[model samples]
Target: MELNSAKPGLLCSLEASQSQRTMYPYVTGTSVVALKYKDGILMAADMGGSYGSTLRYKSVERMKPIGKHCLIGASGEISDFQEVLRYLDELTLNDKMCDDGNSLGPKEIHSYLTRVMYNRRNKFDPLWNSLVLGGVKNGQTYLGMVTMIGVNFEDNHIATGFGNHLARPILRDEWREDLSFEDGVKLLEKCMRVLLYRDRSAVNKLQIANITEEGVTISQPYSLRTFWGFSAFINPTPGAQ
Candidate 1:
């Protein structure tokens, strides 16, 4: 039998596939929480990204804006979320060129993401993330979530990854149709506290954001402290026994 020579097209195809595979990483983030309030929306996520069983990072920001008006809180595949945010930025900028000359609103951005997730699902290569979209829609504040496979749903509150398991219940208990912005912020802090206690992947260092018709406001990181504990030993063990 005679051997067939390698074709340039086949080599090019293989190289292209290998390059894509190499570019994608397996790091994943966890625990994103979001809720809608009377004024707007509040969202938060912990700062941990885990690679398998190892905790890989402690300062990842999982909350960001899509365009100027929409906020997204994401869990899973930090790099993928960054790419999606970039895509959203470009998409919104492109939409500004329409005859209407308007950037993508929150609902429009959510629809775009749904399509992107579905298209990736059809390709059997997914973004491997869950995202919360929060902002104003039709003069009203809106909160919604998109799953890895493109399922999108609206809710008074939403949680993803570890937060779904540990923080959602606490949110559900306090969530109300009439919750004010201050109440929403307090609720989100409480939710983070619950996750910090229950979810091993979560910590006291939290990133919280609020989006409204006015704009987005993110809180600075603050320590969750204990008033009484072993820390009393800093100066001297108080009756060490």
Candidate 2:
């Protein structure tokens, strides 16, 4: 028997096949916390990215520095957040080139990001993230949150994703506009501890960053337990309450 080959134009690929190959899954990040202190802003996020009941990551650093004085902490797709960081880095470098070698400041960075997020939202394909932008704007500490769809608002304290449910209440209760920098730090530390206990996505060892007029300072693997005077494993006496 002779075999015959099908003509190229006579056959078409299945639509379902194309769709299946092109479709990508969406991933959500767990929590991000941001608060404004007297001198600057403090932000932290959980290391975990959960899909359903599964833990995806445990050491992800969701916070990023946009320029010299501004910091951005995000909760959502890690890949998308990384792209935003890359774009911001390029934008900052370009701005510096036009400013006689002076790096872009917090306000300038925030304005640039507002336009970036809005532009993406107009295209109907946003970055799939919520962001906290903070630093000193106009000689005073400033803090704002931007949603995935580009809505931006300033707040004394803001928490997104899982942190919104687990950490925001604690933050709001303790937040004071007249709080000193030290008090602000202590409050944030307490907030992180609460999240670690209540928010499954949050971990005890986490990254913390402070943005101020002086610039951005990031602490690596800051120990929440050390600050709280407790170890990860608690030893209980037989009759302990």
| Best-fitting candidate, scored by TM-score | 1
In model 1, the Cα lDDT at residue 210 comes to 83
TM for every model, in the order presented, reads 0.82, 0.77
- Tens digits of per-residue lDDT for model 2, 1-241: 1123644443333334444221232555667788887777888766666664567667778887776678888887777788789898788778777978576666666677777888887876677778888887558777887877778878889988767777788887888877777787788777777777666666666777888777888887766654434444465467543
Colliding pairs, model 1? none
Residue-level error in angstroms, candidate 2, position 201: 2.1
Q: Which parts of model 1 are misplaced by more than 4 Å?
A: 1-25, 99-101, 226-241
Model 2 segments beyond 4 Å from truth?
1-27, 101-103, 226-241
Report the CA-based lDDT of candidate 2 relative to the real structure: 0.74
